[model samples]
Target chain A: MSGAVEIAGVGLHRFGRFDGTSVVDLGLVAVRAALADAGLRRGGFQAAYCGTVYSGVAAGHKVLTALGLTGVPIVNVEAGCASGAAALDLGVGAIRSGRYDCVLVFGMEKMPAGIIRSSFFEPWREEAGLAVTPAYFALRAQRLMRESGVTREMLADVSVKNHRNGVHNPDAMFRKEFSVEQVLSSALVCDPLTLFMMCSPNEGAAAVVLRRGGRGGVEIAASALRSHLPGSVLGEHTPLSGLIDDTAPPPTSLAARAAFEEAGLGPGDLDLCEVQDTDSARELNSYEELGLCGVGEAGPYYAAGHTQMGGALPVNASGGLLSKGEPLGASALGGIVELYRQLRGEAGARQVDGARVGLAHTVGRGANASVVILKR
Target chain B: MSASRPVRDGLFRDCGDGTARLLGARCADCARYHFPRAEVCPYCSCDSCSAADLGPRGRLWLYTAVLRPPPGYRGVVPFGFGVVDLEEGVRIVARLTEGDPARLRSGQPMLLVVEHLHDDDGTRVETYAFAAAEEG
Candidate 1:
């Protein structure tokens, strides 16, 4: 906590699909906006970090080259969906280490249409149909329902709440709200999960400028990232990695603990949160993993209306990925951008009133989880 | 019927009768089990592993019916996938014979069977799947 690093500025390109926009264009817009917001001219930042999955090699360099901002150290990082957060962690670490007084961190992605095809699995596994993401989600959903009494209605409620919040977020992709009936009745992608319940793997870019020893701006209290431990078959880690051992904690829980310890604050100290809602069940599961609610109690906690807007601690006030669509690399950083705006009192209609402390969580395909805490 | 064979070699094998057993590896150092076989134990991080048959019976841990075929998948649409906890203390993700949710339940006994997946260039490809065991 001694070497305080603050989110000097944050920016984003609207989260949605643009047929003709190149990935470089998406990233250029966000990076330029961030530089302007930070009040930094050329030569202000000493280094840059870019996170992306499918944007190809030298993505960050391409963006900087386009803007004539190349020359400083530009590094690219990827951890599946947590790509942005991973890059942010590196930038925060650099600033904390006094390697750079100021740095740029950004992420962008143009995800392929249809089900996400990860080369993470072997071709034989994909051919056998065991690598489908929705199927994995459904398997987890079914287990959650049995163990936690989470009904399909409760799942629909999460969609309803997040989508309703999305209506106020102009930057989000799907701004329309849907009722519980509509959510549940939407085309079934997998058993116990409808298409509406899943976040679209679309396109977007998010950027954050971090500076050492800043005041007034949102301070990055903690940035912790953890990878999955071996032997957690039932856990949220990638399927087929290990055997069943529920005793092992998922990466989210590990990252949350590390983040809380680093920040010297717990979940109760946060005024609001932006958690991974890759799917409705995932959001609820994150509640338990992040310690926002006790294990197996997320169902009741959510049912009590504690996470909705205007509730005690509103979650996903930026409409979350469920509405914004996941651009993978930008996904985690998008949460940080939302938290930054909320803490700065600039989040228009979806603002969480009197917000001071906020936490953002993102788990990626490598089974990596990142937790970032921000405070005013 | 065209010639059918296991989709991948060394994963599971037909017992020459009607039964199929998954070929797995067990760690000599930690005794942890791994499906699809592993040369090194991920749990113990030791190379002291030996091939073993992961018995035919396991309990269904969870399941889901995929309404659409995954990318690059040539199998039938709406196929069933599940996590099964083997009697050998290993958990594995596999294709299930039953695709309908109503016909699948957690904790039900499952038996390994080699079944047809799809036709690939005039040849029927077979893969290992778990079928619900009849109850008394």
Candidate 2:
């Protein structure tokens, strides 16, 4: 492709929870996998961007220190769930600006099991019992269900559809699926959101090495980032990075529009995609924001099963975060790994045949969105 | 009598006009303003920011009800929080004073009422929160 940043290789440690594994171990395995795939050494990278949600600063140093004096600078990036794409964007920007010939981008996370805490909320608000992310999204979902006439079953349908797709994805967290009745009947995390509707957070890591695009190439056309709608930071810790827990047009749409422009293509031209499927409803909303179809058409698209592996632009063939499990930091990068496989026709049983173009979008805390376009 | 956490808690002031407001900041360089008191002059990066009070009343933009308790927030499941776009053009996130998520709606008008958050070490940590503004 013209004016694109080439993806030399992508590596992923198995996308399962690393409850027993350390973050650096996951990093080494994934980095080795990527390095081997790229036909390069760890020394090949001039700079590195490591993204993680739970792991704080010096995380990149913790990982790179194992590789020895590569002399490459490492920066730790944390953008909630969208950490991978955000870090990749920085690395890609560095390469596109001609500052570095090759940059390595990686995301890894070992989230505290059970409920997570993103410290972008005010202490007072938290005391008022307004800190959990699932609660916030659940509120929105409840409202959307009321306003959109979307049913709990419809939401489950989204999960089932993605889980079915994930059955074909070896890297997904949940390999099996349950009937809509089961999804509806499952235990509730919130009133309408059941265990099935909500994707479980896992421990995982993903890596990609990038250089300038060349012949026989699969390159990054663009990765666009948008600031989330503003929120009260008086006591910031709002989960999901800038939505600030309660107020504005999620800045995600801006990223979608910008990604389209930057890639010199529109959503209609897309062949395949992987988006943040943290929940069934969010994925449906994303189908609209990604411009895959019209507004409020996610129910129809999902009901008609248009997003299946062979449908009009296979969406989330990697089982998405729903089936694959939401590892937050590694979640978006996992999307990249899946897209790369699609473009290379190496997806084997799940490959979208002759896939020439694809996009991967990941959203983070406070409404930060990152869109990455790829072409073979 | 009992110790269940209040949905929200904050100091209240009588406006003498029946109006109470959330605190905020106004920028001197660009006339831009923020709620919860803007610190860094997000508009022009100028160091001049002045504190002021903003409407506790505003339109509900979007909201969520987190069913799970986050790490720091200790409360029962299913908490409602939404973006209240204040009349002053600053949007701040606060717990929907209406503990009932079922009653909340998008674009619905709301007024802020300071309330209690939780008790600290058996003592009240009294902090800022909102209640569904009383309709006139």
Candidate 3:
């Protein structure tokens, strides 16, 4: 856009089950850490944007009020799992429009343990067993397998790689690595997708401080958000909308194209990526959607080890949602925080060496897809 | 058997001949079909849509089985569901009578059927589903 916006600081509350911890408290930890990292005192930032899905009304105001950082504009945003990125999109736009110099952006969630539920589907759909999230994933996975020849083993391999990478991330919820066999053998949540292949809905928080001018920090190269086009049907994130149109481009492709164009960079120039792995199949689907690989080529691309930690164009070096667990609101921002560390060469074990550019993507509720690019 | 009723009115109609047809709307402006019957056409933004019956028998686009019950769902666990392409070119998501992945394949001919979903109170709540055409 207009002026360069840099991530001044980034922070996270370890993702996992924090039983008895209030969602507000979980957000407080991440916000305080982010402010302290940015060397900003209370009320130093001009505004705050909070992203959440289940934290209830005025969730951002609640977090800022607890820190006595009220009186400034505090807006809460929701766009399914892309909530945090949506908030960042707003904050970045505000700064580019010369509305504010410095702003605080954070996302937090204490998920109601188990499957994620959304009001996007009609009551009848849920009653007819047509709205189950896992079932949707499985359906997509089955189609992917049919079209792209992606096998169940390839899906399991995705889980294994992410879990292996998650082993090095202290902020990740499940840090232990699992073998492909284990992932395949784990309880089947739905046909073709096993328990370990799916990302758990859990609790966590992540935050970032954004400033107008770059101070040798990671610059926000581009931020783009896109919604599903009508008649995409299976091509979109949400279920039961429109008719079958295989030609319809998914929201991920739309958002990725916009972000790449804004940054004046293509997929070939990226050093790494952090994409939505809400399920293992989603990761593979993202590879094709992000233009990282040709259509129907993700299976062979992963088989070539091009997405592994030390491999070229590593994806999900932060373990993705697979190991980090999806704390809806915080999921997208958490990826940003990871990219911030990698771009700054601060990511210890999971760091992609000499990484200068990175991309973070998240698709929420099958409707909103966001792509954010960062550069050193 | 207890009294039975459709899960929600206007979704599908069961003919006395053990046949069923999905109810939808066809946009008079763009001639596009919408499942569950929308009052307006999403593509053309035209409100001249009229009720249309999507004939039974289409190709199964995709299918899956839910191993666990979704929250607030009163249906049986591990139910089969799929996206079916109707003969009218409109795609619809509905439950399938088949849950076994071994028995299901993409592009298989499917026919609409009205079946029992679950027992709500004392009545057998029914809903629309798709079954293999050969199974019919």
Candidate 4:
């Protein structure tokens, strides 16, 4: 890949709930660490792409200003969980378009309680009470249970497995393990989805420095993003339409195809994968959409441990947002940070030995999706 | 159970004072029109985007009554959430007013009307809302 933009370095601070630190503060720690990892002077970047949702206006500048980096162009991006991926895309676009050789991409967020009010949702909706993330996931879970033989205990198992993986991740916020029964009994957020199955919002920052003309730790094979438009194939808010496919071949399958085509790679080429497992059912949904297994087959595959490390496909080996704890904008890049560690052969316990290629998929509440493919 | 808020009126108070509406934003340039008044324009990204009133006319997309909500939001129990597709082509999600849910369905029509969204006290506080309606 002669023209491929490379990730020179990636950095992340310990993932945890921040009661005193601001979003901008967490961003600085990660950015500084990434800059050091790349062995590149922070002053060498031409532009900055900052992804955040709840940090408020000039959120990027607020973080960059703390770094004393000025006069550089800064663009704030927000696309829910896809924000970091979207921001990284912007940096890559700039480098590939010949606008700049190097760019800084990162996502920082500090989640607030009581529904995590999405900056995109209109206030009228919140007042009216239509924007519940768990309920939305629960709707999908309920439907999936109705169609598939998967039960709540099965969903609890997903959390159990992920929490086990989380124990291997030193920086994860909630590293304590849980049993299936424990997960099943956790507080209920939405019907059919327990507090354990649903990712809890927290604060953190993940940054990946990208360079155009230089060799790097990993190569970004391909990246893709899409939005759900009305009248489009199975728009989420539009009930008149159904998913693009019912039997199999999830909408994410299309995105995966495009990413692989762009990178000249395929699913069989991957060594490990990280999917948007905001809700446990969502992880099962990803299994089908990502072509890891057939539709309605994820429950069994997961139960049989096909997704665990050393399995056919080691998924969320770094303790996915589900296990690592949720950090909104930073979660996707956090997954990237995990894949980076795996590819570099630096992963300690949950490492997929000899892994060469990795993919990270992120989806937002607005029904937005993004896929990023990286290689050693 | 979150804090109880007094009934608010006139479309949107959850965001801020009268400076913002449930849907209203001025185009910084050309000043054509926009709703959920954006920080910039759907046509262009400019800080000049001013507040523009969104005249009524829209329809419902989908809705469901929630027996419970995640912690934080304090409102009446058993409320409904629905999607509204404005005539301008932008679709938004909102709370469905008190109505026969049997009247709700996919692609069911709707229109914009001012009504008391919730009551913090006995006095009704109004907010812009979407009420299901006929196609015409």
Candidate 5:
């Protein structure tokens, strides 16, 4: 295990469509802002990591070149939607290994308009019409609903809650709230999942600066990543290949367990959290996987104000990806940025009270789940 | 007119006696099964995988309908699909022949069919899928 690392700065190019901006431009915007936020001079970093998908080769080098922050060993990472968290994990590893004191990590994406294209499926599967991205989310949603008693109304409530939070987050894409009726009445993308319940693939970027032994910022308590186990199915966007491993633990649970163990804390130790709300149902399922509530308890737990603002363990206080359209690679980092701000008491309007320790989680298409714990 | 072909080779085979079966790989070392075919055992990493016949029946484990067509998919709008928990213990994602997505339920019996997926050139590319079994 490596030593500790601290986030010195965090920045984001607001989550939404940027019609004329290239992915590199979005990345540079976030990177420069993060450097400025950290009060660090350019070209002073030992290395850099860029997380993205569909952004061609050497994405990190391209971004650095635009910023004139070159000459560093820049590496690009792709882990479906968990790309950003994976990059942050790499940065933390570098700092703890005593190889680099300060490192830059940024994630950006500019998905073509429409349903996000996923190359994770085989050609035959694609041809069978089993490759639509949201279709998998809906399948998982139905399974979670049947198993957990999570109602369609509860799924809509997730949209309502997150969108309400989005109104306060100027950086969020959709800053408007809707009633449960409105969300439920929205166009049905798939059974039990509505248009308003799922996030759109748009464009955005978020960047973080990590420095070992840094003072006065959030400490990285733990960063853990786990791939899909042989048999478990939740959070897996990969095509079903063979016999299901019904006995293995879900990747999120495994990642969360490892993170909490490394942090020497439990779910109750968290003050706030930002989870992968790729859809409302996903957030509900994550509640169980992250151990925020006992299995089959998310519906009641969320209804009782446990996840709302000013309530215990408020989740998605930055409106989540549901309100902040997912830009794939940048989605995880966006959640991290929200938590980082909440930990520092810097989040305006939507800040969690007395927030000290926070968790940010994301699960990608490749069945990779990441959990990061931060402490003030 | 052109003859139909399986989307990929080795998915299913015609027994030349008016009967067909889905092709799966069974591990000789561990007795586990895999859908489609496996070159090696995914569980024990052993190279003792061999072809086995999986019948055309299963139970619906989970399902969903795509209201909009995905890129490169030539299927009609509002198509349904799900995982069929085969009797052989392997679950596979397949398009449902059921037109209405609302009526499909979990644990319902399902039957497999090889149907035209799309047309590339003059060939009717056929693929395997599962549908709700007809009530007797």
Candidate 6:
């Protein structure tokens, strides 16, 4: 595609909890690093987009002005966990539309310590004890296990793998590994899903610089986002309003299909990937949704170790959201930053060798899903 | 006498006798039902929808027990959250009277009941829930 945009530079302020660091501080670090990496000053960009959920209005404007990079259009985007990817889509769109040659995109968030307070559900639901994010994940896990014969052991294995990989990722919040036995025995957040199996809400920031036409950096072949369809009930906090259609395609599957078609590539052509592993069971479920494996096959697929760093298709090489607690708006952008490092062979100990094409997927509480494909 | 109130009005109505029934919105165009009522049809987006009494009967579809209560929740910690598929083709999310996760099973028959969610300064906030149906 002639309109394909290239990722000129990527930067990240390590994913973790910074007790005293303001959201703007984390964002400034990432933005300056990205601009420096791109060999351009902050004033060179035509526009700016910031992705965040909890941060208040004009978050982008505040972040840009702190660096004296003002007088440009700044748009703030919020799509639950996919906020970062949605903002990246805007940057890519602007560049491809010939509106501007270079655009800056940054995603940052400082989340509260306990369970995520999602206002997406009515207050009654929250009072009824149905608003916990992990509760929905556990419900999906129970159904998937009943349908696929997947065991809790298999789910723990996903955590074991991702956490072990996290040890190599200095940017990951939790850089410690846990055994399968340790995972299954961890604190139970919900039935069949343990505390460590789920990603906690925390702080972090990731930024990327995009250019209309570039020769060196990774090319963004496809950047697609899709929201939940009517009659769809699969999301973090969506109310169960319409008739339940168990067979309807979820937003992630739809977005992935669109990205693959746009990129002229299929799952088999991908060398590695970074997906929304908000929880371990989610990673297994995503294997089916992303076409990495068939339905009811992710359990066996993980047990066989096919998704490790050296496996057939390594996923979450940056240790995933499970290792780096989700910073709502910055979650998806973190995956893209990881993919950029992987494509450039700069992932240090977690590098996936000869990785040419990588895909990043993130789904949010608003029932929005984004899939972006990058090729070296 | 203290008044018994539904958490959200129009969600259900008391028969003035001792029993209450759920209020669902039925679409005249698409023949689908919505729980907790709706102004417009969610399926067909048609305004041809009206409130109807959804008799309290459905089968359990999926469920999980919350180990900890969420903010603003005064219900017992570790309460069961479930979805019951009513005969009207709509799935409603509600708390299960069955607190134990192991006792709950998909496809089990269920019946609705109104219980106290929390006390707001001596005012009992009544909310609807589903329990394992008694065998006939």
What Cα-based lDDT does every candidate model obtain? 0.88, 0.73, 0.88, 0.71, 0.85, 0.85
The DockQ-based CAPRI class assigned to model 4 is incorrect
- Output the lDDT of residue A153, model 3: 95
Per-residue lDDT of B31-82 in model 1, one digit per residue for the tens?
A: 8888778898877789989999986888888888887888768888777888
lDDT of 4 by residue, A1-376 (tens): 4567988788897778878888888999888888888876456788888888788898888877887886889999988778888898889888888888888888888886445666454554455554465556665675557555678898888778788889989888778789989998887665577878987788899998888844655888898876653233222332212211123233466667678888888778889999888889888877777777776677677777778877878888888887776677788889888888899999998889899999998877556677889897
True contacts kept of 4: 0.15
Off by over 4 Å in 5: A241-245, B14-20, B134-136
lDDT of 1 at B10: 87
Q: How accurate is candidate 4 locally (lDDT)?
A: 0.71
Where is model 6 more than 4 Å wrong at Cα?
B15-20
TM-score of each: 0.98, 0.84, 0.97, 0.75, 0.96, 0.97
Over B1-136, each residue of candidate 6 has an lDDT whose tens digit, in order, gives 6655567777776665444578888989987888767888866789889888875888888888877778768877767887788777777877788878899888999887776787777777887778898665
Q: What is the C-alpha RMSD of each candidate to the true structure, in Å?
A: 1.3, 4.4, 1.5, 8.2, 1.9, 1.6
- lDDT (Cα, tens digit) per residue for candidate 6, span A324-371: 889988889999999998999899999999999999999878788999
- Which scores higher on DockQ, 2 or 3? 3
lDDT tens digits, residue span B1-136, model 4: 3344323333343434222235466565745444445576644456677654443556655454556653445566555555556555555555556443456665677655554445555545455556666677
lDDT of 2: 0.73
What is the alpha-carbon lDDT of model 3 when measured against the actual structure?
Answer: 0.88
Q: Per-residue lDDT of A206-298 in model 2, one digit per residue for the tens? A: 999898777577878879987764443321134311222333445566788888898889987888989877877777777776777776666
Score chain A of model 2 by TM-score against the reference chain A.
0.92
Give me the runs in candidate 3 sitting further than 4 Å from their true place. Answer: A235-237
Listing candidates in order, what is each one's chain A TM-score? 0.98, 0.92, 0.97, 0.92, 0.97, 0.97
What is the clash count for each candidate, in the order shown? 0, 40, 2, 15, 1, 0
